[model samples]
Target: MRLSQSLIPTLKETPAEAQIASHRLMLRAGLVRQMASGIYAWLPAGLRVLNKISAIVREEQAAAGAQELLMPTIQSADLWRESGRYEAYGKEMLRITDRHERDLLYGPTNEEMITSIMRESVKSYRELPQNLYHIQWKFRDEVRPRFGVLRGREFLMKDGYGFDLDYAGALLTYKKMMLAYMRTFQRIGITAIPMRADTGQIGGDLSHEFHILAPTGESGVFYDATFEAGDPAAAADVETFYEQMTTIYAATDEKHDLAAWEKIPDERRREGRGIEVGQIFYFGKKYSESMNFTVTGHDGTKIFPEMGSYGIGVSRLAGAIIEARHDEAGIIWPDAIAPFRAAILNLRQGDAATDKICNELHEKLGADCLYDDREERAGAKFAEADLMGHPWQIIAGPRGAANGQVELKRRATGERLELSVADALAKVMS
Candidate 1:
């Protein structure tokens, strides 16, 4: 993508309303623009990052045995009423009246809708232990929506539901999801600690919220040193890893227990603010029983299946990633989700020789790089490139281009080396 042809409206000064780092950086870097109070139009660059995050989530969910199938953004009020939450959901749910005066809602969550879908189609215990997921838009009319996408009224989400004939099957599904969440966060380049959390509106006996530690986080999180010690994905067994994670003392402020926290060694206790990126809940028959969804048992008795819901905030993750990975210059995007892996900067834009080298690099990198082919000053180009946070920056100056040389810069480390154009391209691709 050429900068001259792109729609990245990079700003020199921060927008006054952007109170958080992600919010401010996103605006200054031209990733998103506000459409309404908590609604945003994701610009090209922002959409790229969001799509990459969603892809990672889909891959992880599929590997964990969840199948993908999209559900609608709007749901019938009757579905919520069947689950006894139509009136209980409150103002957050955007209730609507259609032309025929039918009550509907922009779904904040899909528990009721998914329950209805599965109930109508799945009727036997043999087809139990099914996991379905979808990545789609969701809305929750927050009373005070702020902090960019962190507390947005509208956002993208990946919500998955699991159904099992019995508690044992549900427990196994829950463990698989826990392992999947750990791997997902790691692949997206964030250390998200799974902490005990209150289920709130989604009634459940067991719940865990995965949070990324950041000073600007909304939740006060407490955990033990062991939670951050090693890679959870490398564990040999999912059940063993799930046991280790659950047993460790980790909780958000609301669930923090002083007695349990003090039981840990003084050196092991740790506390910090954390941004919630995902959560998993095993609500058993909460939704199935309320919605009267049942499957025939082995002996022919009707029984409600145990169910669980797992969610990863797809759009909010962009803000969360920025919160966890940015520096003073701008966002330092994780290579796994960066809009472009590399950016080629033509320091002398109109110069024939410089253009030749940059165009060559751009051609070789293809869709994987952003080529700065603008007529802007060299310093402006450097600043904007840093702000965009591509993993690699290939600098093509007139003098260097004349010598068939270019400077390769590693964005995260700020390491720069002058090498032949071929050498720089090879290093970046590697």
Candidate 2:
């Protein structure tokens, strides 16, 4: 994509309302724009990042045996009422009255809706263990929504629910999701510690929140260093990996136990502030029983299925990643989730030789490269490229272009190499 043809409205200064690093950088980089107090319009660059995060979440969910499905943003009030949360959910539920005076809601979660679907469709123990997920926009009317996408009124999320006929089945599904979340965070180039957390309004006996460490985070987390020593991809058994992680004495401040934390050797203890990116819940029959969702048991008796819900804040992840990865210059995007893998910066835009070389590189890289073809000063181009945070920047100037050489910069490391155009392309492709 050429900068001249793109809609990235990079800002010169931060918005006064922006309170955190991610929020401020997101505005300055032209990734998003505020439309209301807590709502935002995701511009092209922001959408691309959001999509990348969603894709990773989707892949991990699939690997964990969850099937994808789309559910509506608006849900009937009757569904919530059946689950006995309609009134308990409070104003954050965003209750609405249709033109016909029918009560509805912009769904904050899909527990009730999913329970109803399974109640009507899945009828027997044979099809017992099922995990369904969807990546969709959700709304929870926050009274004081701030911090950009991190605590927005409306944001994208990947929410999955598991239905099982028995507690054993549900436990297995929960472990599978825990492993998936760990692998997902690793692939996105972040260290997210799974800490025992209160279920809060979600209502569950077992829950774990995946929190990524960042200085600007809202939650104080204490974890054992052993949790960070294992590789998710290398674990041969999901159950073993899950047990290893959960038993590592990790907890957010709300669940922290000083005695347990102090018992660990001083060298084994670790603590930091963290921003939550995902969570898994084993709620058993919380929704199924309340909604009267049941399957026929082997003995021909009606029984509520064991249930769980897993969630990843797809849009909020963009902010969390930035909070975890950015430096003073701008965002230092991990290669796995960067909007563009490489950028072709035509430093001398109008020069025929430089333009030719850049165009060639852009064409070769195709959608993988963002070509800075605009008539902007070199300083502006360089600054924007850094602020936008592409993994690689291929610098094309008249002198270098004439000599059939270009400079390649690795954004994360700030490593620059002056090599032939072919060599630069080869390195980026590799």
Candidate 3:
């Protein structure tokens, strides 16, 4: 993509309304714009990052045996009524009334809707273990939405539902999801620790929240240092992963166990603030029983299948990642989810030699490169490239271009190297 042809409306001054690093940087970088209170319109660059995150989530969900199916943003009020939560859900739900006098709502979550689907379709134990997921928009009407997408009212989410024949089966699926979540976070280039959490309105005895450590996070957290020592996704099996994760002694301030904290050595103790990115709940029979979802048992008795819900804040992750990864300059995007792998900054935009080298590099890199072909000063180009946070910056100044060399700069480390055009391309591609 050429900068001159793009719609990135980057700002030199931060918006007054943005209180957090993610919010401030997102607006200044032109990733999104506030459409209304608690609502935003994602720009092209932001959408690209969101799509990349969603794709990784879909891949990991499929690998964990969940089938994909999109659910609607609006749902009939009857579904929530069936699960006895229509009134209990509170004002966060955007209840609506159609011209026909029927009640509807922009779904805050899909537990009730998914439960009704299973009640209608699955009638036998043979089809016991089923997991379905979707990536879709959700609305909650937050009363005081702030912090950009982190606390937005309308957002994208990846919510999945799992059904099983019995408690044992439900536990197994929960473990599998834990493993999947670990792998997903790892691939996205973040370390998320799973800590025991209260089920809250979801109503489950077993629940875990995956949190990324950041100083600006909402929740104060205590965790063991082992989480940072090795990759949780490298465990031999789901059970092994689950065991290690659960036994690691991690918790938010509300659930912190002081006795447990003292057992670990001083060097093994770790505490920080945490931003919640995802959560998994093994709420056996909570939705199924309440909604009267039943399946035929082997001996012909009606049975309520155990169920669980897994959720990842798809849109909030974009902000949370920035909160955890950014530096003084701007966002330091993870290579796996960056909008562009590398940016080609034509230091001398109109110089024939520099233009030729940059254009060649852009063509060779194809759509993965963002070429700065704007009529801007070299310093401005450098600043914008850093602000946008491409993993690499290919600098083609007239002097370097004339010498058949370009400078490759790593955005995270500020390390630059002068190399032949061919070598630079190879390194960027690698």
What are the per-residue Cα lDDT tens digits for candidate 1 across 405-428?
999999999999999998998898
User: Which segments of model 1 are wrong by more than 4 Å?
Assistant: none
lDDT of 3: 0.93
In model 2, state the lDDT of residue 202. Answer: 88
**Residue 122's lDDT in candidate 3:** 92
The candidate, 1 or 2, that scores higher on TM-score is 2
In model 1, the worst 10-residue window by lDDT is: 226-235
Each candidate structure's TM-score, on Cα atoms with residue i matched to residue i, is 0.98, 0.98, 0.99
Arrange candidates by lDDT, highest first: which order?
3, 1, 2
- Give the clashing residue pairs of candidate 1, or none: none
lDDT of each: 0.92, 0.91, 0.93
**Number of the top TM-score candidate:** 3
RMSD per candidate (Å) reads 1.2, 1.0, 0.8
Tens-digit lDDT track of model 2 for 300-381:
9998999999999989999999999888879989888888889898888678999889989998999868999988888988
Lowest summed lDDT across 10 adjacent residues in model 3 is found at 228-237
| Residue-by-residue lDDT tens digits, candidate 3, 1-430 | 9999999999999899999999999998999999999999999999999999999999999999999998888899999998889999999999999999999999999999888888889999999799999999999989999999999999999999999999999999999999999899999999999999999888889999999999999999999999987585577988888888999989999999999999999998999999999999998998898888999999999999999999999999999999999998999999999989999999886799999999899889999889999988989998998899999999999899889999999999999999999999999899
